[model samples]
Target: MSLRDRLTEDLKLAMKARDQLRMDVIRMIKAAVLNKEVEVKKDLDDAEMSRIMTTMIKQRKESVEQYEKGNRVELAAKERQEISIIEAYLPRALSQDQLAEIVDSVVRETQAASLKEMGTVMKAVMAKLAGAPVDGKLVSDLVRARLQ
Candidate 1:
């Protein structure tokens, strides 16, 4: 089944099971997609939807960090829960080793011998991993270390 279909089904299950948190997250996702579709005047494909969910997860992670810094442990915990729910809809994240290997290969392919070429290498690496969920920060660090 497609991701949209899965979300619909899960939303139904959440409603039936009285899973308020799951219900809230799924509705938030639908709303985000709907808003984007309205803005772009087109329906988003699965890949686009995946990107939206990934962005949502990234935002939640940043919120968690801020909440922790403010000593709002409860809010941070809630954001973490939301993050876990959102992640369930995305592709599995690449392992650190897997991402490092990809970065290394891209570096070799592009002959990015120095930090000056880091931008080119980063673009190539992100393109290579386009369909899979990855942390941009991690990718940057890997490329930086590899170039160094």
Candidate 2:
């Protein structure tokens, strides 16, 4: 089934189960997807939907960090819960070792010999990992370490 269908089904289940957190998270996701569709004038594919969810996760992570820094532990915990809920619909994340291996391979494939070629390497690595959950910051760090 498409991601949209899965989200709809999950939403229904959440409602029936009286899962307030899940229900809110799913509605937030649907709203985000709908807003993107309106902005682009087209329905998003699974890849696009995953990308949106990934972005949402990233935003929540930032919020968690900010909340923690501000000594708001409860808010940070709430953000983390939302992150976990959002991640449930995404593909399994790549392990750090796996991500490093991909970065190494891409570096060799692109013959990225120096930091100057970092952008090229980053682009290639991201393309290779497309539709899979990855941390861009981690990838960048790995590529920088590998190229140096």
Candidate 3:
């Protein structure tokens, strides 16, 4: 099923199950997707949807850290819960080993010889990993370590 259809189905189930957190998160995702369509004037494919969800997860993760730093445990936990719910609909994440292997291959493919060529390696890696859920930051760290 398409990501949009899956989201709709999950939204209905969340409503039936009376899961407020899930309901809210799904609604937010739908709204974000709709807004993007309106803004871009086109329907989003699964890859675009995955990228949006990844951005949402990244935002929530940052929020969780900020809340924790402020000693707002409850708020941080809520952010974490939202992240889990959002991630459920995203593509499967790559393990560190898998990510490292991909990064190594990308570096070789791009012939990235040093840290200065990090962006070249990153672009190639992102292209390779497109539609797959991998954190950009983790990829950057791995590439940097390897290149350095």
Candidate 4:
């Protein structure tokens, strides 16, 4: 089944099960997608939806960090719970070793010999990743190290 369909099913299950936290996270996802749809005046494809999820996860992580710094343990814990719920729909993250291998391959494929060609390398690597939920920071670090 498509991710959207699965999300809808899960949302219904969460409602029936009285899983308030899970339901809230799913609703947040739907709202984000709806906002994006309104912004673009069209529905999002799976890749776009996946990108939205990734962005939301990143935002939550940053929030968790800031909350912790401010000594707000309860808020940080809540954000962590929300992250776990959101992650259920995302693709499995790539291992660092796997990402490094991918970066190496892309560097070779694009003939990117040095940091001077970082843009070409990044574009190629991101395209190679497509919709998979790999970390951009990790990929860029690997590519930079490999090229150097």
Candidate 5:
């Protein structure tokens, strides 16, 4: 089944299981997906749905960090829970070594010899690694290190 279908099924399961946290996360995801469809006047493909999930995960991570820094452990934990739910829909994240290898390949492919060419390399790497979870900051650091 498609990601959207799976999410819908999961939402139903969450409701049946009385899983409030999971239900909330799934509802939010469905709402986001619907909003995108309305905004673009098109149904989202799997890749687009995955991108939405990835964005949701990223937002939750940032919220968790902010909550933690503000000494709001409860809120941080809630955000972490939401992240866990959202991440269930995303592909597994790349390991540091895997990320480094991909970045190296992109850098070489783009002939990015210096930091000035970082954008070029990043674009190539992101395109190549689309639909896979990768840490942007880590990729930037790797590209910078290679260029230097």
Candidate 6:
């Protein structure tokens, strides 16, 4: 089944199970997907859906960090719970070593040499690593380390 279908099914399950946290997160995801579809006037494929999920996860992570910094532990914990629920729909994350290997290959393919070529290298690496759970910041750091 497609990601959309799976999410819909899970939404039903969450509702039936009275899982408030899961239901809230799933509803948020659905809203984001629907908004994107409406904006683009097209149905999202698995890759597009995965990108949406990634964005949602990123937003939650940022919220968690901000909340923690502000000493709002309760809010941070809530964000963490949302993150865990959203992450269940993502593919297994790539290890740092694996991410590094792919980044190396992309750099080689694009002939990206030096920090100035970082953007080009990042675009290529993201394309290759699409649908995998690789952290963008980590990838950027790796690319910078490799290029410089």
Name the top lDDT candidate. 2
lDDT (Cα, tens digit) per residue for candidate 4, span 1-148: 8888988999999999999999999999999999999999998988899999999999999999999999999999999999999888998988898888888888889888889999899999999898988779888888889989
Task: Give residue 57's lDDT in candidate 2 (0 to 100).
Answer: 98
**Model 4: residues with Cα > 4 Å off, grouped in runs:** none
Positional deviation of 120 in candidate 1, in angstroms? 0.9
Global lDDT of each candidate: 0.94, 0.96, 0.91, 0.92, 0.87, 0.91
Q: Candidate 5 overall Cα lDDT vs. reference?
A: 0.87
Over 1-148, each residue of candidate 3 has an lDDT whose tens digit, in order, gives 9989999999999999999999999999999989999999999999998888889999999999999999999999999999999898987888999989999998878888989999889998889899887888889899999999
The sequence of per-residue lDDT tens digits that candidate 5 reaches over residues 1-148 is 9888899899899899999999988989999999999999999888888888888888888998899899999999999988887888887888989889988888777777888898889888889888777777888888889899
| Tens-place lDDT digits, model 1, residues 1-148 | 9988999999999999999999999999999999999999998888889889999999999999999999999999999999999999998899999999999999989988999999999999999988688889999999999988
For each predicted model, how many residue pairs clash, with residues at least 3 apart or on different chains? 0, 0, 0, 0, 0, 0
Give candidate 4's TM-score.
0.96
Estimate the Cα RMSD of every predicted model relative to the unseen true structure. 1.0, 0.9, 1.1, 0.9, 1.2, 1.3
Instruction: List runs of model 5 lying over 4 Å from the truth.
Output: none
lDDT tens readout by residue for model 2, 23-88: 999999999999999999999999999999999999999999999999999999999999999999
List pairs with backbone clashes in candidate 4.
none
Candidate 2 wrongly placed segments (more than 4 Å): none
lDDT score at residue 130, model 1, on the 0-100 scale: 86
- TM-scores for the candidates: 0.96, 0.96, 0.95, 0.96, 0.94, 0.93
lDDT of 1: 0.94
